[model samples]
Target chain A: MNAIIRSTARCLRAGAAAVYLPVRAGARVWSASPPRRLLCAAADLQKDLGAMVKKDKVVVFMKGTPAQPMCGFSNAVVQILRMHGVDQYAAYNVLDDGELREGVKVFSNWPTIPQVYFSGEFVGGCDILLQMHQNGDLVEELKKLGIHSALLNAEKESK
Target chain B: MAETADHIRDKLIEELAAVHVDVEDTSPNRCAASFKVLVVSSQFEGKPLLQRHRMVNTCLAEELKEIHALEQKTLTPEQWEKQKSQ
Candidate 1:
């Protein structure tokens, strides 16, 4: 498991490096900012994130994968999605990439992990998701995305 | 010194002008690394959920560095009253 995690981390880093190289090279030439390198790196990460969130209808950046969340908060997020029958979403394990873990916080301007995105829009963390779930806002939000939540079906079946 | 629930409560009350703040230390050993908080303030009025959370995050930026998990429920005073009545 450790080996697999390590390899995955390596691949992610390599992928980030591939994205970073071109930006760094381009910035080296004519970038006027005094902190040119830092700015370029931040911009590159943001660009990557901008694409990543939109790549799926739902995206979750959490402490662990949906199948096995490492933290209780992350577990709660996984559970909530599962309860809504939202199975086919992008889940990024922040534990694998320190840079991604930190970068996402800055990207979303959120301070915690287990950040949820719907249709590339920033949803709140576990607390907000729980609130939405309780208040029935999640069902409406899911419907907007054309997803018929399982809970809604279940409610109908029960009645 | 490690942060206590009262410390967080005081900070939120002060920084956000919170009318009601409840901070519970949920760490297994009372280590102060994890917390669950409910904050009610007029500052959260007219703000979306994410923005309200961001306000609390920014208010506790330094404390969050030492904390592990933070669960927040932010509401405007009116919302808080509604919830309480319910």
Candidate 2:
């Protein structure tokens, strides 16, 4: 039995009865009669969202607008990309959709934001982006797309 | 695939007499899968960010395990009002 007890009318579907498992707090979540089916379904949703991120060559899901990012991290990505001169990328703001905002997690298998997906692959977030930019790897990656990064010159003053 | 963000939201609604709360699932791109949360409570006036986040984390610890990211935007009703004013 699952130790921690809480109750709500859970929907396996909309207003449908699903397995009622005993989730004991200390015990394994589902040792007996697993909620595997429901979990798989949920996993599927997360998977789908993950797929969408990779669906584009470069997708930038951020806050506010790309022109004026609301968060520091978002701002950093915008700044770095501008420096890179890689002008074409998609930006989706989670702020607009409460469901997409909260439910996007299951899709990406990731947990943080300013999530950038590139070449239909999981590109790391802000820190990774900065690291890549510093190493010239980010520029090289963009050049693979036939876009030469102007960031090389931008780094001149800093260096 | 874990618990729905709504499940977390429901718990908050049950626990707090919340007029406004928002939960965002941010698992698509970072490590330690997380949910970006914005909660407006009359309960959180003088509390700092750490304390406010801790409250939500504690309330949803089980879900937190499944959930790797918790981006919280916690504000008091007064604070929220101030944002609106601005």
Candidate 3:
């Protein structure tokens, strides 16, 4: 049943892509002369992205791992989540998997990397996270996930 | 090839009824691969940040195929007015 639902979702996504992004639909972004690795790593990326998103309450498909992020944008997101008292989230390094990297963009229907998901729901990337943090929405969202932000709690207690 | 910043700017103004739109190419060497966009529109008044980004993303779905990266700051007309003053 789960597999059936997943395939149906994939079909719907493909349909939407054709209708929405007709120019780039069904075409993988490859070099002028595509490398062997790029062509060969065409794994089932939709399944991989889905598994990763469902793997944890919070998941970040970023350029590098949390300890050492490759990009400034990814690093910024990691730091913000840390400041919010989050330390346990799944992080996938897209740099390691070409297929995963391209698949992720398609899966999220988002152009950038360092995408964040909360409880299987797609959240926005760096800018959105920053805005949520600034407006105190991140704290509330974390609370709903049963993850408490120590910094937020401290601020509350001081008031 | 992706559309130019001017094209994106004009499209956003037309589609989103944007009051202010700034699309800057942020890639190295001034390439059009990446962009930073700030859009102010009355349409975003009641939407959350995620939805606002989604709206912008959807608006530029075709352009996004060639534009490798995009960082967006979406704001409402009232918020944009406040930002301008400050």
Candidate 4:
């Protein structure tokens, strides 16, 4: 009651613990709620994409894995790379993760599946790959990355 | 809401100050899910094809978030003029 206030002050002392307790406890109740679930979902997928790209000198985020490409465009890129003797590159199946499927487009800022990367850099998708192959630029690019293709010599011999 | 081909085209032209732009809705059902774009801008001069495409992608970032597919052929004004005359 007013006993503590009166005793401590010439007229008053501290109030009852009840008065300060509830207000201080309430203000100190900082819950620190967890981050939103939706953000984590996308963030995880983007982290996965980043890691996947970094793992290989050549990384393709396609609709399906190399063995069983689900999309024609993806299959086309896979075939082209194989023809160029790129046998050990990594390929991520965007279809497996819904977040990955969408996150990749944002990650590359290119609105297409079958996106390609070289040395952790965003290479274009199927069309650019095909064009580069036709122009004999793909072979040179791969060579710069320490990837060799006997097919380049074979094509020259055939020509 | 979904954006139309004309809307995307106008936005690209406005943003890039492109000399020429053609936006085509390539969706099988014409639902605006896919688009093919050919843009000619002096701003693209000296940029590699990847960088040129990147420029277009950046300009249409908002539209791209909603659209499912995009194919781009970016060219400088001189390249565009050469192709046209050819």
The DockQ leader among the candidates is 1
lDDT of 4 by residue, A38-79 (tens): 223345546656666665678788877777888888999989
lDDT of 3 by residue, B17-84 (tens): 99999999999978898899999999998998888998999999989888878899999989988888
Model 2 chain B worst lDDT run, 10 consecutive residues: B28-37
Candidate 1 stretches greater than 4 Å from native: A1-40
Our tally of clashes for model 2 stands at 27
Give me the runs in candidate 3 sitting further than 4 Å from their true place. Answer: A1-44, A153-159
* Candidate order by decreasing TM-score: 1, 3, 4, 2
- Estimate every model's Cα lDDT from 0 to 1: 0.82, 0.62, 0.78, 0.75
Tell me how far candidate 3 lies from the true structure as C-alpha RMSD in angstroms. 11.3
TM-score of each: 0.82, 0.45, 0.77, 0.74
Model 3 earns a TM-score of 0.77
CA-only RMSD, every prediction: 9.7, 16.7, 11.3, 17.1
Query: Which consecutive 10 residues in model 1 chain A have the weakest lDDT in total?
Result: A19-28
List ranges where model 2 is wrong by over 4 Å.
A1-51, A153-159, B1-86
Better of 1 and 2 by TM-score: 1
- lDDT accuracy of residue A76 in candidate 4: 92
Candidate 1 local lDDT, A71-147, one digit each (tens) = 99999988998899887777778887676788899999888898999999999899999999999999999999998
For residues B51-83, what per-residue lDDT tens digits would candidate 1 score against the true structure? 999999999999998998898999899999998
Which residue segments of model 4 deviate by more than 4 Å?
A: A1-48
Residue B8 error, candidate 1, Å: 1.5
Per-model chain B TM-scores are 0.96, 0.82, 0.96, 0.95
